[model samples]
Target chain A: MKKILIITFACLISIGSFAQGNVITKHFADYQQDQSFTKVNVSSKMFSLFTEIDGEDETEKAVLDAMSKLKGVKAVVSDSGTDGAKFYREALSRVQKDGSYEELMSIQDKEEEIMFMVRNDGDIIAELFMIIRGADDFVLMTLYGEIDLNQIAKISRILKISGLEEFGKLGGN
Target chain B: MSSRFLIYLFLISSFSGFAQTKLIKTLKEEDKIESSYHLYPSTLRMINLQNDPAFDELIRPVKKLSFSILKPDVYTSKDMHTAYQELLNEGYEEYIEVVNDSASMFVVGNESKSRTCILVNNDEEYYIADLEGMINVLKLGEVYESIANQDTSKIGLGTVFNYVMGENNEKRERAKRRKEREKNGEKEAKKESFQVTIGEEDNEKKDTTSEQVDSLNAIEEKKENE
Candidate 1:
């Protein structure tokens, strides 16, 4: 009993939670497996975007574009590509017009998965996950890197194709 | 305005109108075609794949969650070299192998990009990727593609690919046998290593069990000598 207790203690001391990449791997797999990964994450932001609480559209669009550019990313809408576009529009609106800057930075870090916005030291990055299946399957979409959401959204909007009503739904992850 | 200029403008406008009429005619004819013949191959494929077991398996979570991390099991350099050749053959001549274990990506169209996405990771349980949904067939067994397009059936490409992986009876049997052989080999290797370690430890402690009896016998002999 004493040997086991010591061994267990030693193991706990040696391994940190994040250090164990296997756990993270499992989480990614599990979240993706159930199709719930994208659903939960996308809906989490849908409320904020729908209400236009703040710079939601602007932030949303940037995240969408960044995800589209990412490798392993396919389509970026479930409701429709238009909904994804609308979400991007909301996301882009949130870009720093004028704020404490520091306050925005703080709120961003607390933001959970499916959406994140960060600006610091003149550098900026925004990423968000979208429900990317065709109104059925849900897959996570990650959009991030050093670029403004507004710019990406503008470019994306210009490229929008026709025949997508669900795509126009603004509520996006 | 000169009559010559007017005539030129009229001619150009008339030609444009004529061309527009022809485009409309073509579109109308396309619309007139029956709905059954109008379905895109990719769209049909998407419908067929909805009921496939393999597709469901891909979307489901693994119980133990093992993904074969795309690393070089044989030769590291050779694996990279093969990826490069494959990219080049695929018509994306650009290649890069920057960091170890990270296969560089390559883009064949639209942009000049090099990416390493076609990796077979065996251990990383979860693989979430967005792929163009059109490709539907995979062929294996024969070294070459079928010169004889014998069958009248128009099967989705994914079906043929799945078949090659385990569709045919012969292929399925061969795969099963191969897996069994590999499992047995691994078991034997483990047992051999375990035996060697245990044998060494046992040898070191061989005389300790009977040491007390031997010591007593030595004492008896000493008493006799006295």
Candidate 2:
């Protein structure tokens, strides 16, 4: 009877882990068709092409190197007129419920709240997810597959992705 | 029976291609919409004129391009939303989207071969572009920025507008005057007699024409007074 109980508990834990794969991806899909929200998905194929480019400068070389390891990037942004706080709270709760990601840092100011979370593969970071809720905007961006915090911020600046400059604070540059 | 089947297959394939761009077609059919289409060769020639190698290389892969601009007063956000839904129904894969209270833009592609980008801004303007063949969409911003930064004085905007509007009245008038001069064998004499710079010659001609207009007006006023 004791053995059976232990086996059942182990099976339940495995099932729960399997179900909690990626909250951001699932949430992105839900809003892809929503007219009020903006979405961006860059496939690995696009990133693979970046690896072949010969950088003309040091900054370009660093950005290219960081981009090579990325599998994909997905983002969902809400319009300024909408209630950004609601989406931020909902995403925060979902991340907490998943129980797999560890919170790296968080900032709360008078105008905005930002949270950075990561799911690690041993010592290396596998995914870096960021949630930002401003007075007039809400942004959810996820960069998965072998992330380097230092270089990731540079990629956002080079790409001119609107809400991603916040990552610069993490890189301490 | 096989021949009939082949005919039907060909007809279906041709129509499916049109169906893919049905949204653009519908918008084009609307009244008061401004649209333009350009093939690769003409577009390449135009880009070459810019003399920027980076900008030229970026657009080499594009086979064809077409765009339409719509006014927000005629097409509301709700209408744009419906059009977006129709694009999804037509099997376009969403690539990028940016939406805010005042404006929204989205890019969708089909199998990496064709791309459609749509931007709608409330109470302002709306634009759509359909491009064939693959180009790095991310580098587009950089290319445009480089072009925008180029020296504007060298572009000769007045001549470009005249060319686009198909109004070359000044050129035709000058050609006619030159032909008449050549026929009278006065071209060489006139060229030898004119030693002034081009700028000074234009100013001299303008001064003479304005003086003639003022004399004619003075004569008309004196006649009325008499």
Candidate 3:
């Protein structure tokens, strides 16, 4: 169990360099997406996520899988520990108005440890959801955030990818 | 009521009229919902729950997973006809399922109209090289809620469990469980399963329903495993 968390944590070493400026007009010409930055250097893949927490004690891989498929990502890494003590801090902040809360039975089937790293095209997007579950404990954490979509546009322009501009304008129009 | 008054009324009517509504004109949306979604079935049992015949047909051809690397599951059955018939009801009128072997996969939702899909795989054994490798299945402008909210009701979400159980030679376990149940004279009631999401607002009620629904097979299955 410890080994899994360690490996997942190591993979999450890239998610935090998203603190800056880059904007580009929509590109639909070359079907270009991920037009944000020319180069991406993530700091802490897990910490950079804008996360939400729901209060409950359940454990499973479904939650992890759900977070992995979120967009604006190119990769992800997950691992965790059994630290139910951590839940109090996150749930206070993670609950949302969308009724987006996913629940679990309890910390019963606890194999609790999770970590993830992710990006889109090439920029760090979200590194969400991690927990540590023991036979009687669980810790849940999540992150969500918007990447520099504008930078994605600029990168597409620089690369001169066609159709990206058109795709971008699909909504901006 | 004279011609002059009629002209005045016509002018007023023309001035007061609102722009005619057009299908394309109104849907010209700026804040468009990307409508992206992803699904990660627990395991291969999900195939049985498929309720879509075409999805089953897609699975039928795949006898084995030859190799791994850049692998993804794509269901090519244009016509979904299966015992579980849920896809037809949930708007998967035409779709595909991409199986990246036993551990992972990529699916495109409603291939006919909007592209969407769900993915599932093992993180510890296979996801060694790339951490976010599993997410390659997601497309732009997708929402998980929209797809799963509609699909899981009919087929059931035990696909993941089925997958895990399946990997461990679960058919053997299930058969054994069935025998044990027969020895004990246990009969499964209400063969026609229905998923009724009774309450969303009240937590207690939902919990109560969840508890009541844990049937004997489930209870026995847990005890036998232990």
Clashes of each: 42, 0, 83
Descending-TM-score candidate ranking: 2, 1, 3
Model 1 C-alpha lDDT per residue in residues B41-71, reported as the tens digit of each score: 3333353333444323221221111111121
Error of 3 at A37 (Å): 25
With candidate 2 superimposed using the best TM-score fit, by how many Å does residue A128's alpha carbon deviate from the native? 1.4
Q: What DockQ results do all the predictions give, each relative to the true complex?
A: 0.02, 0.15, 0.01
Clashing residue pairs, candidate 2?
A: none
Better of 1 and 3 by TM-score: 1
TM-score attained by model 2: 0.52
lDDT of 3 by residue, B29-71 (tens): 4211112112222222263454543333322312221111111
List ranges where model 3 is wrong by over 4 Å. Answer: A1-76, A82-148, A151-173, B1-143, B148-151, B154-170, B174-226
Local lDDT at B177 for model 3: 89
Question: Chain A structural similarity (TM-score) per candidate?
Answer: 0.27, 0.81, 0.19
> Model 2 chain A: which ten-residue window has the lowest total lDDT?
A19-28
- Which is better, 1 or 3, measured by DockQ? 1
